[model samples]
Target: MNRRDPRVVRRLSSLRRRRLAFVVRETAARVTRILLIALGVLILLAGAVLTPLPGHVGLPLLVLGLMVVLRNSFQARRRFIRWQKRHPKLIFPIRRLMRREPEILLVAWQQLLRSEKVVLRRPGWRVLKRGRKAVRKALGKTPLS
Candidate 1:
């Protein structure tokens, strides 16, 4: 069935009809964007947790989260583009990995291996550990991402 009622459309003034439709559209878009951002964050956190698992679900989930956020968030999209520009070596492998082709994983691994610099992201974890210990001594939980 067609959702919009013809009688309702005919009854409203042209400008009022436009405004009502505009308001509904804006509200829907706002809700959708917020939901997408929340979902993206949840996916990203899950990915981080899954990263060290034996089967290795982390990268794909992380990339998926990134794509969701980039699609809904202008700032995130800009930042990701900037980051890609800054780390050209990392971008190709990530793009290949996100393609979801069976043989691409090996290609991505090779691309990563051929890169000159290995990026170790342990510093943040170390700092978080220190903070957690400090917060434990203070009898408070450290809410870190």
Candidate 2:
């Protein structure tokens, strides 16, 4: 545990060695950050263009773009946090997608079931009511509630 020990001295000497000048390191980091922001913007634009086309393609691209932008840009992160605070409900789905293990299928199924419930509220829609009941049960909810 001595500061002047031979082993400690070698570690400290290695720590002081610089592989690159400070300015080079800073410039490289800035360039990389700019490239990432540009790439994120491009992805976002692509997502917007593809959104109107069909299937479940564009949403993932949009989420991926948002994640890249948020990761690389401090301003974007600040704005996202502010928006998230102001509109938790609107931001919830994107936040879910940004998770390490996003439950895409489950989220889609839940949304589908919710929309079905909203659309088929009449008593005559017995088939969907049964489906709703099954979904509720599978999700650990009581059917009556």
Candidate 3:
């Protein structure tokens, strides 16, 4: 539906592909970090129980594990900031889109509801209610108090 120049379309598509790849890489890095941390803990426990292995080995493993965790945390934070900058929609596009196609409002709602950041058993209800209210206000509806 976007009748833009071919070059523009190509650029946009490439950017989207790159962003998706980055997200996948970020997720993989996080998984690797968790596994490394777990392995480090296990190594530490083994070092404690088994007197044969030098304490130095376990200390290095723990240090490496902490480094991996820190690296992943830093990368994730940077990626989040980059994503926010590159995809402003992730933060504020709902209001703009709601003005154009009110019917697609439910799509946005569904996205927020199904977000991984929303812990379903915890404060999810509160977040959902707040999201709904925000969306409703964006759509120019009289929001429920």
| lDDT tens readout by residue for model 2, 32-101 | 9999999999999999889999887788889999999999999999999999999986787788889999
Residue-level lDDT tens digits of model 3 in 1-145:
4649888899899999999999999999878877865675565465455545655454334334433443446664476467758887563443333243443456546566657345665664567767778889899999655
TM-score of each: 0.62, 0.71, 0.35
Q: Give lDDT tens digits, candidate 1, residues 1-145.
A: 2437776656566768899999999999999999999999899999999999988689779888977887899998888789889998667666666564635657654654444223535544444345556877698765545
How much does each candidate deviate from the true structure in C-alpha RMSD?
17.0, 7.4, 22.4
Query: lDDT values of the candidates?
Result: 0.75, 0.84, 0.60
Give candidate 3's whole-model lDDT.
0.60
What lDDT score goes with residue 118 in model 2? 76
Cα lDDT for residue 82, candidate 3: 75
**Candidate 2 clashes between residue pairs 3 or more apart in a chain or in different chains:** none
RMSD of 2: 7.4
Candidate number with the higher lDDT (1 or 2):
2
Report the error of model 3 at residue 45, Å. Answer: 1.4
Question: For residue 62, what is the lDDT in candidate 2?
Answer: 92
